[model samples]
Target: MKLMLKYLKRYPKLILLNILGIFSFVAVQLGIPTVMAWMIDNGIGNSDIAYIKKMGGIMLIVCVLGGAGTILLTYASSRISTNMIRDIRNDVFIQSQNFSHTEYNKFGVSSMITRTTNDAFQLMLFSNMLFRTALLAPVMIFISVFMTIKTSVSLSLVIGGSFPFIVAGVIIIAKLTNPLSKKQQKGMDQLNRISRENLTGVRVIRAFRKSEYESERFAETNDNYASNSKKLFKIMSFTQPAFFFLLHLAMMAVFWISSLMIDKGTLQVGQLVAFLEYQFHAMFSIMLFSMVFVMYPRAQVSANRIQELLDEEPLVKTPTNGITAENKGVVEFDHVTFQYPDGELPVIKDVSFTANKGETVAFIGSTGSGKSTLINLIPRFYDVTSGSIKIDGVDTQNYDLKALRQKIGFIPQKAFLFKGTIEDNLRFGNPNATPEEINHAIEVAQAKEFIENKPKKLQEYISEGAKNVSGGQKQRISIARALVRKPEIYIFDDSFSALDYKTDATLRAALKKETKESIVFIVAQRISTIMNADKIIVLNEGEVVGMGTHKELLKSCNIYYEIADSQLTKEELER
Candidate 1:
């Protein structure tokens, strides 16, 4: 909350106006019982109808001013609160884009989404309410108690004795409900994760007939969230009854004592009437404090959650004077060893390889053999666990991320497109790309056919993640998006898996001419996909067992030879 309060510094004038408004409201509220005390004890005691009418007029005007102040403060508080929340939400989202891969993975995707949305919203609720009511509540409560004690200290005993119970109730309920509310937010994360996963892979779940299992998983998460919510509310529910009961009991005691004092000729009936209104004021103030009690704990937890993400420092940083290069493509992996974070050993052990400018290098490995892992390291996405990767004879780590990524183009196995027109998605690779450049890239990636067939051609709209298009079409558009940039090095991580054999052959053939001056690396499962490359690597059990042309590997390496034999037909092998 302190972190959030820093934003209020931007709105000092507005905050002051809101404070003035709250003060005005509390002033009129406090004056109400005070004026009543005078009307009963002074005006009615003398039977001065004119004096009573005058006090009544003043009270009515004070009430109008209070109502006006209420509107002003509520409006001011809402505007400030909404703007502050917008700033916070923007910062959270922008910072997320800069988070290191490890940092992002640490919290998990679902948790980040939950924090950005639900947790931030909780903080907003408390901020809005506190701005409007928390400050005024104390003003009314303090002054009311002071007035009651000044009138008669003996009657003050009623407030002194029972207000403690209300405070205690708030404390106990806050302590119990707070942790449960935090747990509920975590459960909400799991629920969001299940929903997102199902939506993203709806086809696969349906194809495999796993709807029942997915439904069970979703229900478990929903029930957990519901149970946590119920626990928090059950505790929070104590405030209302406990407060009103304490107030009424205290009021009863005050009435009995006031009657005795009046009979004893020590207190007046009008004074007693005014004293009851002050008691009501004190009780309502406690109610407002109860609300603050309920809101603060939830906000504190939300603030903590948001702070964790903001405080996270990305593990990777560019050097003070990072290099920026303009050389032709030259990628080298020198004695590179790496592993997934939880793996027992390095998945790519003591691997050394180089691909010169304009050369094509392919990694051919079976599943779990670390081909994709090697491809990922070149761009510094998942950095090498040990050893160095270089581009243009300079260590990639020494290049600012902007300079390193700008020169390399990537096409992943799973194609993703944003919600926009085809032209908009294509322009993401190079926003300055001309119409001619976009059209040419589309032709090269074999996406032109479908794009041209659309009603709006390049302007055709795509739904989120390109759900409007087929898998192969989306892959082609993704490739076109990369090609439009004309990057120095293009890495295709099995980007052709969905294409038919004929399309795959055509795509590779087109690449030979269009990408002749650009280095190309591909990770492939099919022998035919990487067969025509200048050089190929075969990784197995975290080591490179073969590095040669297709014919040379067939002659020399058992694993590579077996792969080629198993994946190719006899007649094709003879050819």
Candidate 2:
């Protein structure tokens, strides 16, 4: 409720309107009973036709007013609930935008989606009930109980006697459903995760002939979700009938006891009729309150899930009033060390290097040697565990995150393209890039031939996940995207692994001229890819074992020599 009120308070006028509607509705409900009793005792008993007509007309007017009030209440509740949910979803999305890989791993992608969408929807349903029925229930109960006793204190005990049973049942239902609600939500998360994995990894599943295994995994999760839902629905289904049974018993007792009083000549027939009306309203109000109680556990569960997401503070936070750099060309790693949040050992340890303007520095190593991790530090994707990384002689942490990233163009090993035209994806790197800059980037990345072959060329639409293009095409487009940025530093994390050797050589030669004034870093496995680099750094188990040019490293660095020996011919190695 604390989380709910934070958003509910934004619309004060709607709250006031809802309140007005509740009062009007309650007034009509209570007043009609009194008017009926008056007609029975004074008009019908005395044969006064005019009084009957007058009272009938008044009841009609009150009913019309009550209908208007119900309409107003519904409108207010709907507007407030929908708007509140919209605002909450927006905040969840904005908060997620600031999350790093650490946070993403903390809450899986499927769980986050459930929180933003399903959990928020639960809150909306609860809020709508809160504004419509929850508010009116209390007011109705208080007034109805007062009128019931005023009509006959002895008869009111029937209603009062049934109250404790309803309260006890509501409490028991709440307790039973609380744990089940939690399990139900978790089951939903697992179901979504399996479905997401199956859809995204369909190709791998088919290639490995694991389609049956994948199907079984998904079916198991779906069954768990369905079982929890079935259990929850069973409990709720039992509640309504149980409450009605108690209501009927109370009504039977009221009728039996009131008949005895009427025979004793102490209770008039009209008063007896009025008493029953109040009893029904009071008992019905309790049922409404019980519904709110039963639904509270599920809504509270959803609320906690949503609040957990909003409460999470990202491990990497942007500093206020961050420093700005004068030049963005030079890059330096001063004894940087980094460990994963859950790892037992550091992935990159005490590594240091510097690349001046107009230098091409390459990194080569066996898999899992921190090649990608080292480059990720430059863009502050993960901050160093101990030492500071400086760009243009300024500590990376000191610079504003956006300002720091704007200085470098980074392309990952696995190329990814959004669903859009070729030009749209290219413009993502630099939104204001000119046609001339785009054409130059395509030529340098060696993407011109394939793109021009397409009927629409730049306007050609790329499907989701770039499924329409080949591996090499995606890599070139990714490279061209970075080239369009024309930043001071370019870091390609094995971005050329998809291309043939000839294309790789041609692209690198073109890059030498295009990026002569900028700092460049490349991580590759092939010896020929980095043999022409100005400097090459050899890594082993996250440590920099060798730092020198290809020829120099072949003499001093055993790790470099072995890697080059594996991929390079005797003639290429000597060259």
Candidate 3:
């Protein structure tokens, strides 16, 4: 409710109109019975046809006004609810954009999707019910109760007797369903997670022949969600019939007592009919109020989930005022060390290096050697645990995040492309890039041959995940994307592993001329890929065990010599 009120307060005029509609509706509902009672006593009993007709005309006018009120109520409620949800969804998406890699790991992707779409939708449904009935029921009950007492105090007591039972029933049902609703929502999150995994990993499952195992895993989660839904439905189903049974008993009691009063001539037929109408209205209002109680638990659960997302504070904080000074493309890692949020030990420890403009530096290490983690720090994907990283003699932390990232073009190990045209994906690096720039990037990436052969050329549609292209082709396109940016620094993290040696050698030759004025860092497992690099830094575990050129390391470092010996023949090593 606190979450809902924050957004709902924006529409004060709609709330006022909704209140007016409720009053108009209540006037029509209670006024008709009074007019009918007067007609019975004066027109029917005295046989005056003109008076009866006059009262009927009044009844028609009251209903017409009430109908207009109903329309106003529907329109107001719809606008308020839809507008509130739109605002909420927009804020959730904006908040998610600010989250760092740490925050993304904290709350999984599937859960965030559920909160934004499913949880928000639940709140919208509840808001519609709240605006339409939650306020109207209380007003109707108060007015109907007053009218019943004025008609006859003795009969009003019977209606009053049912109040405690209705209130108690509502309280009991809410308590019973609150825990069940919580479990149901969690079940929904798990169900979404499994479904997403199945869709994205379909190829892996087929390749490993684990189709049956994956199906059984998904079925187990689906069945749990269905079971929770069934329990909620059963509880809701039982409530309505039980409440109606109680209503019938109250009605019987009212009719039996009213008959006695009329038989002794203390009450007239017209008054008896009017009293019954008031009694029905009062009881019906209670039923409507109880329905809100029944839905409250589920809405509360959804509201809490949405609130969690909005309340989250990202681990990475952007400064209010950040430095945007000009950089000369000098990257220095001074005794830098880093540990993951949940890690027991550091992944990159006591690492120190420097690379200036017009230099090509390479990192080669065994698996689990922190090559990717080391480069990720340069872009501030994760900050250093101990020392500072400086670009052009200023701490990377002090530089504006956007300005720092704009200076570098990073190509990840696993290539990923969105569902769009080949030209569209390339333009992501530089939205306003010219055709000449695009052609140059493609030629350097070794992607020009395949792209030109396609029927649509640059306009060809790249399927989701770039599944339409082979692994080597996908890597080339990803490399082309980075080249289009032409940033001051380039970081390629194992991006050439997918390519054959012939293509790898050619791409490097092209990059040598294109990136001569920019700092380049490459992380590779193959020694041949980095043999011609200006400098090579070798890592073992998290520490730098060797640092020098290809020949210098071959003579001085055993690790470098062993890696080279495994991949190169005696003739190649001698050369």
User: Best candidate, lDDT-wise?
Assistant: 2
The C-alpha stretches of model 2 lying farther than 4 A from their native spots are: 268-270
Specify the poorest-scoring 10-residue window by lDDT in model 2.
323-332
What's the C-alpha lDDT at position 540 in model 3? 89
Residue pairs in collision within model 3: none
Relative to the unseen true structure, what is the C-alpha lDDT of residue 221 in candidate 2, on a scale of 0 to 100?
Answer: 84
> Please, what are the lDDT tens digits per residue for candidate 1 over residues 282-367?
78887987888887888888889998888887766667778877685788889999876666878889999999977899998779
Against the correct fold, how does model 1 do in TM-score? 0.93
Candidate 1 worst ten-residue window by lDDT? 312-321
lDDT of candidate 3 over 1-575, digit per residue (tens): 99989998999999898888888888989998999999998889889999999999999998899899888888888888999999999999999988878878888898899989989998999898888888888998999999999999999998899899989988988888888899888988898898898898999989999999988988998898889889888887777787778778987987898889889988888888888899888988888888889889999999998888889987666666877766687999999999998889999999998999989999998899999999999988888899999999988888888888899999998888889999999999999999999999999999999999999999999997788899999889999999999999999999999999999999999999999989999999988889999999999898999999999999988999999999999998888
lDDT of 2 by residue, 256-363 (tens): 998899899888888888888888889888888888988899999999999999999987767888875658567888999999988899999999988999999999
Q: What order do you get sorting by TM-score, best first?
A: 2, 3, 1
lDDT of 2: 0.92
lDDT (C-alpha) at residue 404 in model 3? 86
Candidate 3: count the clashes.
Answer: 0
- Global lDDT of each model? 0.87, 0.92, 0.91
